[model samples]
Target chain A: MADLILLFFLLVCAVTAVAQRELLNSAIILSIYSLIMAVVWVRLGAVDVAITEASVGAGISTVLFIAVLTRVKRREEITRFRVQVLPLIVVLAVGAALIYGTLDMPDFGSAAAVSNTHVVPRYLEKGVEETGTDNYVAAILASYRGYDTLGETTVIFTAGLCVVLLIRSEKKRRL
Target chain B: MMDFILAKYNFWIYVIIMMIGFYAVIAKSNLIKKIIGLNIFQTSVFLLFISIGKVEGGTVPIYQGVEAVYINPLPHVLILTAIVVGVSITAVAFALVVNIYREYGTIEENAILEMSKTDD
Candidate 1:
């Protein structure tokens, strides 16, 4: 029942956020959407993901969006809402294909699902003894998947570098 | 029919959310709106993965002394990194949008394209 309500709100927020003409309002609504997503994660038994989504998805992303909005226009131009037919058709086609793909997926929250039956068992069974961490997620992230984390760090560093370069170029152009 | 819908509703919801974002990305003329749509699209994919990790009667993947069902930790770990990466992508995208605004004095895609075409 709770999951149903949360999903309903999630759907509403996603639609509302996209439909808004004001960029700031859209960003704010997106933040609310992220917060609801965090709660949904908790209900799904993913505490770590819930915390990260609450902080990063709702917090930092909103701040960055607003910061950019300040430097740009507040409201989208073209007051009237015009629907583009080509994009709408394309989106509907893709969505229908995705729904068809989901037809074979296991029922929601089923323990016997393929995802739960695969290599996840070893991680759950021997994770603590092998990694000496009370949290399986931490153990997997730091040990079993440490290289992926390293790659992610590198990606973030590259992004920061790109932002710095972009700002510097803009300043030089101004001068 | 009801049981099928109940069993697969999460997937359907995610697909709907993803499509909403996709429409915004491709249909919206404003660059920032496209980025916002991209964010929504990315987050929905994360939700899909996490939902796949859920177990019927499981707790968070923490090591408790008692025998307990722990939801799949692997997806959580992967998504933890992905959430951070998603933000990084957003930052880069916004930077590009800011630069586009700086050069063209507008962030609408159609306007920018028109400006660039006339520049040629």
Candidate 2:
């Protein structure tokens, strides 16, 4: 019942955020959407992901969006709200195809689902013994998948470098 | 019919959200709106993966006495990294958008395109 309500709000937020004409309002709505998403993650049994979503999705992303909005126009140019037939058709077609694809997915939250039967068992069974961490998500992230995390860090570093290179004022260079 | 809907509603909702994002990306003229759409699209995919890892009756993937049924930890770990990466990508995208505004004096796609065409 709670999941149902949260999911419904999720849909509402997604639609409302997209429909907003003001970029700042849209960004704020997106932040609220992220907060709802974090709660949904908690209900889905992912505490670590919920925390990250709360911080990064709702917090940092919103801040960055607003910062950019300050430097650019906040109001999207007023255009006639005519139905964009081509994009609408394309979106509908893709959505229908994806819905058809989900027909074969295991019933939601089923323990016997394929995702649970794979290497998950080993992870759940031996994770603590092997990694000496109470949090299996942390253990897997830091120990089993440390290299991936390192790569992800490098990606973030490259992004920061790109931002500095792209936006820093030329006056700063001379100074 | 009810069983079908009950079993698959989450997936359906995700598809709807994904389509909403897709629509914004392709239809919206503002570059920032397109980036917002991209964020929504990325987050929906993350939701799908996290949903796949859920167990009907399970606790968070942390050690809690040997008897606890923990949901899959792998997906959480993967998504943890992904969320950070997604934010980084958003930052880069915003930087590009800021640069575009700097050069063209407008962020709307149509305006920028028209300006560029007149430049040529």
Candidate 3:
């Protein structure tokens, strides 16, 4: 039943992407998509990832796109069609390959899996002593992968700066 | 039946939501609509995380009776942080949107492009 739901949601995403005529409505659909995705992540047991996805994926990215949108005016007709036959074929082939790879993955949250048996046990047992932090995800993210986190922070900062530089104006438009 | 419904079918539904959101951000010409789509995308991800922490017959991760079997509290903590981050990002995005609206007379992508070309 869950699988069916997931399949249906995938259809929704595909339809939303391809069928929507109004950009604003598309954005709203995207927000719904993000919320739905958060639910999926929780089910998958990747709570940390889900948190990031919810915040950065749905929240920040949506806002950024909206801000960028304000700088432009809606055109009655699309001037360019970014879809090209070659790129479309390439994307489809890549997507197929990815789906094929999924066949090899362990069943979600199987105790036999390496993630549950090896790394996770160690974290659960000794993470407190090692990091002196109650939040293991925080410990892993901030300490174990501190450098990567720093890099990610820098990336966000840079993105924010770029957007500001690109869109800031000396005067205001009333519209 | 319930397990199959919750475990198997739910994942795909979330994936489709993501695609819809992605489509809105990419295909739509309107800026505000794109933002809305992006929000939908993000919210789906949050739902995914919350679902991950759920254990069958488990209660909320709070202090309770000795008989209670606790679900992992870590995900809950992480989400708390994520909530704050989401809000901050939204605030910043709104600031940018206001600026963008002021600079450009409209919110459509093609119109902005035309205006740019004419100016050059």
The per-residue C-alpha lDDT of model 3 at residue A50 equals 57
Higher DockQ: candidate 1 or 3?
A: 1
Interface RMSD of each: 0.9, 0.9, 6.2
- lDDT per residue for candidate 2 within A1-175, as digits (tens), equals 9999999999899988988998999999999999999999999989999999999999999999999999999998956677699999999999999999999999988899988999888878888899999999998999888999999999999999999998786235446
Winner of 1 and 3 under TM-score: 1
Deviation in angstroms for B27 in model 1?
Answer: 0.2
Candidate 2: what is its chain A TM-score? 0.94
The candidates, ranked best first by DockQ, are 2, 1, 3
Two-chain DockQ for each candidate model: 0.88, 0.89, 0.18
Which pairs clash inside model 2?
A: none
Error of 1 at A81 (Å): 3.0
CA error at residue A92 for candidate 1, angstroms: 0.8
When 1 and 3 are scored with lDDT, the better candidate is: 1
Candidate maximizing DockQ: 2
TM-score of model 2 (CA atoms): 0.97
Q: Candidate 3, DockQ to 2 decimals?
A: 0.18
Q: Count the clashes in each prediction.
A: 0, 0, 63
- Model 3, A1-175: lDDT tens digits are 5745754674575466445665555555555655556656555555565566677666766665555444444332455666545544554564456445434544333335343354444555665678877556676667665665566566557657755654454343332
Runs in model 1 lying further than 4 Å from the true structure: none
Model 1, A1-175: lDDT tens digits are 9999999999899988988989999999999999999999999999999999999999999999999999999888974567889999999999999999999999988899988898989888888889999999999899999999999999999999999999889889999
DockQ of 2: 0.89
